[model samples]
Target: MGIKKEIEIRCHPLMSWDISNPILSLKSRTKEDLKLLSELSKQNNWEVDFAKELAMSYQTLVLTDLQQTILWVNAGFQTMTGYTADYALGKKPTFLQGEKTSEKVKSRIREKLSKGRRVSETITNYKKNGLAYDCLITIIPLLDSNQVITHYLALEREAA
Candidate 1:
């Protein structure tokens, strides 16, 4: 019998140089922008509204459970990942994590998430192009009644 062949797919990587965070580029207090994100998160159509206001050119990722189900994504997500909303929705954000990701860093994230607190850390992520980029990830634990973590919200920016 002939040998069978198998195929695998992967997330593509983004290639560029020296791009600062858009919030940092505004030349004003980024604290305000950061604060606004908190306020907007309470809104119903937060994903669409915030992406339009912030001019996000990449996907805005949100996880609705510790298992990392994608809860919300904006148009930028489609543009960056070359995947439509239907394909990306409900998928795990770890789709971005790969062989290049550091186990130590991932361990740290797991530790923090398990504690039910906001965690900020930078780690490597492979984009849809299979190119590597350093993503500054800020993960927030969303709490429900009685302060139980109902979800995790993640924001990412390219490293300076």
Candidate 2:
């Protein structure tokens, strides 16, 4: 499919942004999703290009602030986790963890993230429906132009 070039101006309390025009024809995205992407790009001085690419390649995308508070999630996240963006927002990713989750793996991930490293792990994660599934997660520390870690981008998919 070809790319769709559309100009949309969305206003938020902090700022107003005109999305970079041509949005990829990967999937159906809501206006809030587009606005979140725009805000993330503007706030971090990063391009939304990578997000678009990742959206197509990954089943789920989770964006979290430095404190690990969830900032945004792509539509695939809801499909995969059975949790809406409204419910997931402001919550840490740990909320997905349950008794079946491994403490050792969690510790290792924490160690890597604390040092600003990228981590990949396959761990058991609980869905909103109380079912556990093996999930492969890749967490990358997002850096600003100043070379400081500002946020994290986690790409997740069910482990086969």
Using TM-score, give the best candidate's number: 2
Note each model's CA RMSD in angstroms: 11.4, 9.0
Stretches off by above 4 angstroms in model 1 are: 1-59, 79-83
Can you list the residue pairs that collide in candidate 2?
A: none
lDDT of 2 by residue, 47-109 (tens): 335645455345677888888988767766766898977788779999999999999999999
- What are the TM-scores, per candidate, against the unseen true structure? 0.60, 0.73
Error of 2 at 47 (Å): 7.9
lDDT of each: 0.55, 0.71
